[model samples]
Target: MSAVEAAPRVEGRSNRGTATWMVVPALVLLIGFFALPYLTIITMSLREASTRAVYGEGFTLAHYTTALGDFYIWGILGRTLLIGATVTVISLLLGYPVAYHLAKSRSRWTSLLYIFVLSPLLVGLVVRTFAWMIILSNNGVANQALKATGLIDFPLQLMNNSLGVTIALTHVFLPFIILPLLGNLQAISPDLAMASRSLGASRMRTFWKVTLPLSMPGIQAGTILVFVLSISAYVTPAMLGGTGGRTMSVLVVQYLVDNFRWPAGAALAIIMAAVAVIFVGLYLRLTARAMRRLP
Candidate 1:
């Protein structure tokens, strides 16, 4: 090639080099923080559980074996899955209407409504959990209101249980479901529902057939997100559920902090991560197939 041809090639290479250089910092940060720590966890998980040391010598699968054999761990895992599923379903059920209204409404109050829905998220998880503790306590506002209304003879056992954890978690994760659903609902054209109605469909029918199907992508996204977060949640469960509301994450923390079993904790954490990944993957695959079959 001539000098003129080589000049353009040199300029292209320089541009590519600049782009690579610009991305280097982000790559370094990801590897240093996220990737390295995750790899360390995997490494630590293979070690034997030790009370005195961070990790014991030699590789052993005892931690994983213990997790599998221990009925308490299984119970915690079951509770984690149950709570996560419950929270996801409840959030979706409650959030859909709010999200639909937000997407469809053109009123001045829509902005205010949006802000109100997001207000809970602005509060810290610990603060929100503490607030729930107050509201659900024996002499708290909820019981007082119930008593004033003659709804019950005594205060309900709302605190320090799975119900309290679920309630707080549902509130905490509602916005996650709503935001995604709202985006999906907004992308749908109003004319589709109108057209369905024009073809002799009732409002409910039109919504069931036309609106619901189209909003499924958002539902899938929100459900996966909420479920993952719920399964991994620790603070709300620990604060609200007390001794009975132990989940996988709480168990992991107990192993590490309370029991001083770092290897066992790491193994449990790895198992949690694996389960989440598998669940999400299967869900996505099923959702994709279902969507593809839709007309």
Candidate 2:
């Protein structure tokens, strides 16, 4: 009885050890790369600013106080949030139709269209931002085309502003929204829409009443992804925004790199991450409630 019982126990212990060893590399990487950096940021955020060094020796809440108290910082935060929301909404509006067509149509060009949508993403972000800068400049293609068409007497101020940043960001992230919506649209059976049509529902009516509701999960996922990425973006904002279009991410970089205020930068980064997490939480709660209300 002792040998039999001990044999199974030993085998069970060996299996458990094997599983633990399998997970150890992942745990080590997470702790070493993510957990340690995030913990360091939290510690840095609570410290005082140092003139002679990256951070001071004493504990202080001054960085948090400064970040929260300053109206300029709040304005940047507000703009970041606003842009993020705007981009998400615009991406949804533009992407949905393209996604629907891609999912439903049997055109020969479908693969090409998909490639076109994703091609921008294949290029580096910095390269894409610089390209936008060229196109949006005063005498660039956009202004030249408008002027040639007699749409305006002068070049539109497209670059170095919020509008430029928003436009570029929308373009950059549009594929993200489209891909998810396409997947969701494809998951939906065509028979539902066809059945509604057979039952005398108009095409538009069937779309609104049947198709749209089923697509909410995809919409929510895409919106959250676009918004989070938009808010956290740094290079696009820096290149297109200049001073007038400054966002929270740009400010974080300024604090850390230009001003050498590590504590302040760390505080700002933490705050930004917190805001994103809170927004995601609230969005998920609201989405769940909405889903529950649906059939």
Clashes of each: 0, 0
Task: Compose the digit string of candidate 1's lDDT tens values, residues 60-152.
Answer: 998899888989888888888899999999999999999999998999999999998999899988998899999987898899999999999
**Candidate 1 segments whose C-alpha is farther than 4 A from its true place:** 1-24
Give lDDT tens digits, candidate 2, residues 1-295. Answer: 6998799889999999999999999999999999999999999999988899877889998888888999988899999999999999999999999999999989999999999889879999999998998899999889999999999999999978889999999999999999999999999999999999999999999998889888889888999999999999999999999888898999999999999888989999999999999998999999879877776
The C-alpha local distance difference test score for the whole of candidate 2 amounts to 0.92
lDDT of 2 at 111: 97
lDDT against the true structure, per candidate, is 0.91, 0.92
Regions of model 2 farther than 4 Å from truth: 1-24
What TM-score quantifies how close candidate 2 is to the native fold? Answer: 0.91
